[model samples]
Every structure is written in structure tokens, then in C-alpha cells.
Target: MHIVITGAGRGIGRTLADRYRAQGHSVTGTARDGSAEIILDVTKPDQQRAMASQLRDTAVDLLICNAGVYLDKSESIVGYPTEMWAQTFASNVTGVFLTVQALLPNLRKAKGKIAILSSQMASHTRAPGGSYIYRSSKAAVLNLGRNLSTDLRHDGIAVGIYHPGWVQTDMGGPAAEITVDQAVDGLMARFKDLSLENTGCFDTFDGQAHAY
Candidate 1:
């Protein structure tokens, strides 16, 4: 399968890229620093268009919208500036949508699957008292993925939203619960299980259905 992953320079995205490549699949990893196979800042329209055109002739078996940010992690109720919210929404919410829109054609060509790396924080049931920007952005993306599933159903495209767990990465911090390897393994399994029949499902890395 030909897999394309955004934000693959580090953390879960990087691990996923390595794991897929080790399994003998064709993987296209994109990073903003031009360090991966493709240089793409998901929030940039020009870069998104360039990526789509570059892969215009290729069929994408899986498109993982993994690029995101958690800008308000340490911000208090009074600390969340308007710019922070805008930046977070651009990276986490709008970025995911743009990637999906840009790759719609490639996905259609292969009847591919889209795995959106949302968070348990996105769920109303898991709501906490912090990270307002991150939480709202994730919730927005969850909504985006669900609606995309409905809109793209006839095209044979499946979209699944997932909470990848509290992974020990630069974003998740070293004290987080899961290791990168563990998260990657579980996420890969979840991705493989995605299908049209179960499109728009919000699930955890370990395969449990998460409350939307």
C-alpha cells in the first residue's frame, strides 16, 4: 500500500512512517522542514497544492492527517491569546481539512482510507479544565472527519477519527502513559481495520470505540 503521512518528522508520525516502511509498504512522509520525503506545512495552501500535484499520478492507499499542534497546553483561562487560538485551529482543524481536500482525487483512485489523529480530549466525555485551544480544535476536526465520511461515502473512501493515547513524545511529554512503539502498533492496527462499513468511527488506539 502507498501511504502518505503528514508531520512525519518526529513523534508518532515518524514512528508510523518507519513501521510502515519496515513492513515493505511505500511511504511518503512530509515535514515542514523539508526533512522528510515531502516538504509540506499542512496549513499552507501553496504547499498543499504542490504536494497534490506532485502525487497527481500516484494512487494513495492511505492518507494519515497527523499534522497538528497543542498551543494552549500550558495556557491558563486568561492566557489564551486570540492569536494562539487561530494558530492552533489552523494547524489542527483547518490543516486536516485542507489535506483531505487536496488528496481527495488520489484517495478516490485507490478507494483509500483516511485516519485522522484526533484526541480523547476532543470527546465531551473526556473534557478537562485546560488546553482549551487544543481541545476545541480537536473537537472541530472530529466533526470534520465525520462529515467528510458522509460526503465521501459514494467515492469508496473511508474516514476514521482516532485518539492515539497519551504517548511519550515531544508533544505528549516523557511522563505520558504509552511508548511511541506501543502507540504506533495500536494505531497501525486501527488503520488497517478502517473500512467503508465503519467509516466515521471515533476510536482509541487499542480499538475501543470512543465517545463522540
Candidate 2:
């Protein structure tokens, strides 16, 4: 499988890239810092275009939108700044849209699947206080993924939004609920089993349905 993963410089994205490569699959990992095969800041249209040009209609079996930011992790209700919201949304929301849009042609050529890495925080049922910016951005991505699933259905593409669990990563923190490997193992299964029959699902890494 030829996979394109954004934000593969570190954390879960990095681990996914490594694991996929270990399986002898072709992986095109992108990051803003030039730490991956493609240097793409997904929020930037020029960079997204550059990525498209580099791939040049190459058949992409899977596209994973994983680049995101959690800027309001510990912000107080009165302390959430306007800039933080804008920045977080840019990376977490707009970035996902642009990446999917730019890669649509490649996906179409391969009848591909898009796995959007949203969060459990995106679900209204599990809504807790705090992380306003991060939560809202994730929710937006989940919405985007759902709508994209509808629009792209005619193209034979499947789109699924995922909560990768409270993973032990830089974003999820060391005290989180699950290890990276555990999350990845489950997530890979989810991705592999994703099909048009189950498109637009807002689900967890461990193959469980999540309330949206």
C-alpha cells in the first residue's frame, strides 16, 4: 500500500510511518520541519500544492490527516486567546481539509481511503471541560470527514474519523491511557477494515463506536 501521512515527524504519526515502512509498504511521510519525505505544512496552500506536484497523480492507497495542534491544553476559561484559537484551528481543521482536497486526484486514481485523526474530545457525549480550542478544532475535523464521506462516495472512496485514544505521546502526555503501539495496532485494524459500508463513522482506535 502507498500511504501518505502528514505530521510524521514525531509521536503517533512518526510511529505509524515507521510501522508501515516495516511492513514493506510505501510510505510518504510529510512534516513542516523537513523531517519526513515531504515537507508540508498542511495549512499552507502552496505547500499542499507542492505535495500534489511531487506525487504527480501517484496512486495513494491511504491518506492520513494527522497533523494537529493542542494549543489550549491547560488554558483557563478567561485565558483562551484569540490567536491560540486561530492557530489551532488552522492546523487541526483547515489543514485537514486542504490535505484531503489537494490529494483528491491521487486518491481517486486509487479508490483510496482517508483516515482522519480526530479525538474522543470531538464527541459530544464525552464532552468535558477545558481544551476548548483543541476540542472545537477536532470536532470540526470530524464534521469535515463526515461531509467528505458523502461527497466522495461517488468516487469510490471511504472516509473515517478516528479517536486514537488518550495515547502516550507528546500531545497525549506520558500519563495517558494507552501506549502508542497499542493505539497503532488497533488503528491499523480500523483503517484496514474501513470500507464504503462503514464510511463516515466517528470511531475509536480500538474498533469501538464513539458518539459524535
Candidate 3:
């Protein structure tokens, strides 16, 4: 399988890339710092186009839209700034969309699956207060994934939105419930089971259906 992963510099994205490569799959991992196979800042259109050009005519079996930011964490309602919201949405929502848009042709060639790493926080039922910017961005991406699933089904492509669990990563913190490896193990299983019949489904890393 030829897999493309964004934000592979660290955390769950990095781990996912490593595991896939270890399994002898062809992995195209991207990071903003140029440390991976591709240097892609998902919010940048030029970079997105450059990536598409690099992988042109190649069959991308899987595209993982994992580049995201969780700014505005612990911010009070009045403390949230406008710029924070803009940056968050750009990375978490618009970035995901642009990546999918740029790679549409490659995905079509392989009838690939798209795995969008959303969060349980994205659910309306999970709203418990702060991190408004992060929560809203995630929710928006979930909506984007669902809509993309519907449109891409005709192309024989599947899209699944996921909550990768409270992972022990820079974003999830040390106190988080699951280790990066644990989260990756579960996520890989979910990704493996993704198909047209389950497209647009919101699910947890462990395979449970998540609330929209």
C-alpha cells in the first residue's frame, strides 16, 4: 500500500508513519520542517500543489489527513482571540479539505480510503466548556469528511472520521489515557476496515461508532 500521511513529524502521525513503513508499505510522510519524505504545510496551497505534482500518476492507497493544531486550549470564553480561531480553522478544517482536493486524482487511481483524524471533542454531546477553537475546528472537519464521503463514494473512495483517543502525545499530554502505540494499533485496525459500506461513519480508534 502507498500511504500518504501529513504532520508526520511527531505524535500519532509520526507513529503511524513509522508503523506503516515497518510493515513494508510505501509511506509518504510529510512535515513542515522537511524532516520527512515530503515537506508540506497543509495550510499552504503552493505546498499542496507541489506535493500533488510530486505524486502525480501514483496510486495513493491511503491518505491520512492528520495535520492539525489544538490552540486555545484552556482559554476562557473571553480569552479566546480571533487570530487563534483563524489559525485553528485553517489547520484543522481548511487544511484537511485542501489536502483531499489536491490528492483527488491520486486517490482515484487506487480507489483509496481517506482517514480523517478528528476527536471525540468534536461531538456536540461532548461539549463541556473551553477549547472552543479546537472543538469547533474538529466539528467542522467531521462535517467535511462526511460530505466528502458522500461525494467520493461514486469514485470508489471511502472516507472515515475518527477519534484517536486521549493519546499520550504532545497535544494529548502525559496524563492522557492511551499510549501512542496503543492508539496507532487501534487506528490501523479501523483504517483497515474502512470501505464504501462504512464511509462517512464516525468511529473511535477502538472500532466503536462515535456520535456525530
Candidate 4:
């Protein structure tokens, strides 16, 4: 598979890139630091278009929208800085939208799949309090996946919103239950099984579907 992963400079995204490469797949990664195959800021349309230009003639089998940020340190919504909340949404939500939108043509050529990196906290059915900024952003991504799936169904593209679980990465912190390798491995397993029939579903790394 020719896969494109975002936020690949570090953490789960980096680990996923490595894993895919190890599996002998062609992988392209994007990050703000310019450390991957492409330097892309998901919030910027110019950057996304530039990245698309770089892959213009190529068809990507998979696009993983994995770039995100957390504001767990903030105490409460009332105490949260509105600017910070907007920034978080820009990276986590809007970034995913722009990146996927920019890459749709390439993906359509391949009848590809899009895997969005969401969070367990996004589940309204299993709602957990706190981390309001992070939680809400992920929830928004879940909806994006749903709407995108509906809109793209006739295009033969599959979309999945996934929770990698509490991975032991910078975002998940050191005490997280799963290692980045394990998390990525599980997601890969799930990715292999994704199909248009299940597009718009929310899933965890372990292959179980989540309540949206």
C-alpha cells in the first residue's frame, strides 16, 4: 500500500510510519517540522495543496489523519483559554478536514481508505469528564468521519475513525497501558479489515467498535 500519514515526526504517527515501512509499503509522512517526506500544516490549504502537488501523479492507498494536540493541563472549560481551544481544534479537527479534502482525488483513483485518529474520550455514550478541549475536538472528528463517509460512499472510499487507546507516547504520557508499537500494530490489523460496509464506524485499536 502507498500510505500517507500525518504528524509523523514523533509519537504514534512516527511509530506507524516505521511499522508500515517495515511491512514493505511505500509511506509518505507529513509534519510541521519538515522531518517527514512532506512538511504540511493541516490547517493551511496552501500547504495541503503543495503536499498534494508533490504526490500529484501518485495514488495513495491509505491516508491517516493522525496529527492532533491535547490541552489536558487546563482545569475546566471556564478556565480554558479560548485561543488555545481554537488552536487545538485547528490542528485536530480542521487539519484533518483540509488534508483529506486535498487528497481526495488521489485517494479516489485508488479507491482508498482514510483512517482518522480519534480518541476514546470522543465517545458520547461512554463519556468521560475533563480534557474538554481534547475531547470535544475528537468528537468533532468522529462527526467528520460520519459525514465524509456519507458524502464519499459513491466514490468507493472507506473511512474509519479510530481510537489508538492510551498509548505510551508523549500525548498519552509514560504510564499509558499500551506501547506505541502495540497501538500501531492493533490499528494496522483493524485497517486491514476496513471496508466500505463499515465506513463511518468508530473503532478502537483492539478492533472493537465504539458507540458514537
Candidate 5:
């Protein structure tokens, strides 16, 4: 499998990249910094297209839209800074939207899988109030995944949304329950089990289905 993963400089993205490479797959990790195979800033459409063009003649078996950021402080829904809200959407929601759109042609050609990194907080059924920016952005991504699944189904592309759980990464913090390796391993296992029958379902790394 030739896998393209974003946000590969650190955290679950980096771990997943390493694990895939170890499994003898050709992996291209993208990040703003570090020794990424592709240098990409997803928030920038030109950079996203340039990166996609690099793979124009090739087939990508899996596209992992994993780049995201969590705002340091929580905001009230009514009182949130518009600038901060827009920035959050820029990376978390819009970035995923553009990255997938840019790569869809390649994915369609290969009949590949598209996985978006969402969060447990995206679950409407278990919605807890707080972390307005982060939560709302993740929820948007989850909804995007749902819509993409429908839009891309006829093209034979499988789209999914996954929550990596509370892994011990920079975003997850040191006190998180799982290690980066564990989370990525679980995610890989889930990815392996994906099929058209389960397309568009939001799930955790453990394969547990989540409510959208």
C-alpha cells in the first residue's frame, strides 16, 4: 500500500507513518516542518495542490487526512473570538475538506480508502459542553466525512472517520491512556477491517462505532 499521511511531524500521524513503513508499505508523510516526504501546509490550497500534483501519475492506496490543532483555551459559543474560530476551521475543517478534494482524483483512480482523523468529542450523542473551538471543528469534520462517503461511494472510494482515542501524544498529553504506538496500531487494525459495508461510520481505534 502506498499511504499518504498528513501531520506526520509528530503524534499519531508520525507513529502511523513509522508503523506503515515498518510493515513494508510505501509511506509518504506530510508536515510543515521535519523531514516529511512531502512538504505541505493543508491550510494553503496551492501547497495542497502542489503536493497532490507530485503524486499525479502514481496511485495512492490510502489517504489519511490527519492534520489538526486544539486551541489552548476554551471559548464560549457566543463570546468566541471570530479570528480564533476561523483559524480553527482553517486547519481542522477546511484543511481536511481541501486536502481530500485535491486527492480524490488519485484515490478514485486507485479505488482507495480515505480516512479523516476526527475525535470522540464529535459524537453528538455524548456531547459534553466546553472546548468550543476544538469540539465544533471535529464535529464539522465528522459531518464532512459523512457527506464525502456518500459523494465518493460511486467512485469506489471508502471514506471513514476515526477517533484515535486518548493516546499519549502531544495533543493527547502525557497522561493519556494509550501510547502513540498503541493508538496507531489499533487504528491500522481498524483500517484493515474497513469495507464498503462499513463506509462512513465514525469509529474509535478499537473499532467501536461512534454516534455522529
Candidate 6:
């Protein structure tokens, strides 16, 4: 299968890209700084267009919208700046939408699947307070994925939102619960099981259904 992953320079996305490649799947990993196979800043429309145009003749079997930011992780309720919220949403919410829109044609051509890397923090049930910008952006993308799933049903495209767990990556921190390898393995399984019948499902990397 031909897989396209955004923000694959590190963390879960990087691991997924490497694993897929090792499995003999064609993988195009994109990074914001041209550090990976493709140079795509998910927040940029022109870059997205360029990517779509470059891959015009290729069929994408899977498109993983994994590029995102947690800009407000350090913000407190008293000091949450407006710019932080806007920047976070641009990459985490709008970026996901733009990627889907830009690659819809490729997805339609191959009847592909889209795996959106949302977070359990997005769930109303999992609210533990703080990180307002990250939480809200993730919640927004979850909504976007669900609606996109319904809208693209007839096109044979499946969309799923997932939480990759509290992985021990740069973003996830040293004290996080899961390792990158564990998260990647579970996520790969989840992606393989994704289908039109299960589209728009929000679940953990380990396969448990998560409450929205």
C-alpha cells in the first residue's frame, strides 16, 4: 500500500512511517522543514497544493493526518494568550482539514483511509483541566473527522480519529505512559482494522473504544 504521513520527522508519525516502509509499503513521509521524504508544512495551503500536484499520478492507500501542535501545554488559565490559541488551531485543526481537502482526489482514486491523530484529552469524559488550546483543537478535529466520514462515505473513503496514548516522545514527555514502539504497533493495528463500517470511530491506540 502507498501511505502518506504528515509530520513524520519524529514521534509516532516517524515510527509509523518507518514500520510501513520496512513492511514493503511505499511511504511518503512529510516534514515541515524538508527533513523527510516530502517537505510539507501542513499549515501551508501552497505546500499542500504542491504536494497534491506532485502526487497527482499516484494513488494513496492511506493518508495519515498526524501533523499537530500542543502550543498551550504550558499556558495557565490566567495567562492563556489569544495568539497561542490561534496558532494551535491552525496546525491542529485547520491543518488537518486542509490536508484532507488537498488529498481528497488521491483518496477517492484509491478508496483510501484517513487516520487522524486526535487525543483522549479531546473527549469530554477525559477532561482533567488545563491545556485548553490543545484540548479544544483536538476536540474540533474529532468533530471534523466524524463529519468528513459521513460526507465521504459514498466515495469509499474511511476516516477514523485516534488517541496514540501518552507516548514517551518529545511532545509526550519522559513520564508518559507508553513508549513510541508500543504506540506505533497498536496504531498500525488500528489502521489496518479501519474500514467504512467503522469510520469515524474514536478509539485508543490499544483498540478500546474511547468516550467522546
Task: Encode model 3's per-residue lDDT on 87-184: one tens digit a residue.
Answer: 99999999999999999999999999999999999999887888888999999999999999999999999999999999999999999999999999
After TM-score superposition, the amount by which residue 102's alpha carbon in candidate 6 deviates from its true location, in angstroms, is 0.7
The C-alpha lDDT values of all candidates are: 0.94, 0.94, 0.95, 0.91, 0.88, 0.94
For 141-168, candidate 6 gives per-residue lDDT tens digits of 9999999999999999999999999999
Candidate that scores best on lDDT: 3
What digit string (tens of lDDT, one per residue) describes model 4 on residues 1-212?
99999999999899899999998999999999998989998888999999999999699899999998886555665677888789999999999999988999999999999999998889988765778888899999999999999998899999999999999988888999999988988999988888998998899999988877
The reply for model 4, stretches above 4 Å from the true place, is: none
Kindly report which residue stretches of model 3 are placed more than 4 angstroms away from their true locations once superposed: none
Clashes of each: 0, 0, 0, 0, 0, 0
Candidate 2, residue 10: the lDDT equals 95
RMSD vs true structure, all candidates: 0.7, 0.7, 0.6, 1.1, 1.5, 0.7
Query: What is the RMSD, in Å, between candidate 3 and the native fold over all Cα?
Result: 0.6
Tens digit per residue, CA lDDT, model 5, 49-100: 9988898857878999999988734456666788888888999999999998
lDDT measured at residue 22 in model 2 versus the true structure, 0 to 100 = 99
Q: Give candidate 2 misplaced runs (Cα > 4 Å).
A: none
Relative to the true structure, candidate 6 reaches a TM of 0.99
lDDT of 4: 0.91
TM-score of predicted structure 4: 0.97
TM-score of each: 0.99, 0.99, 0.99, 0.97, 0.95, 0.99
Question: What TM-score quantifies how close candidate 2 is to the native fold?
Answer: 0.99
In candidate 2, which residue pairs clash?
none
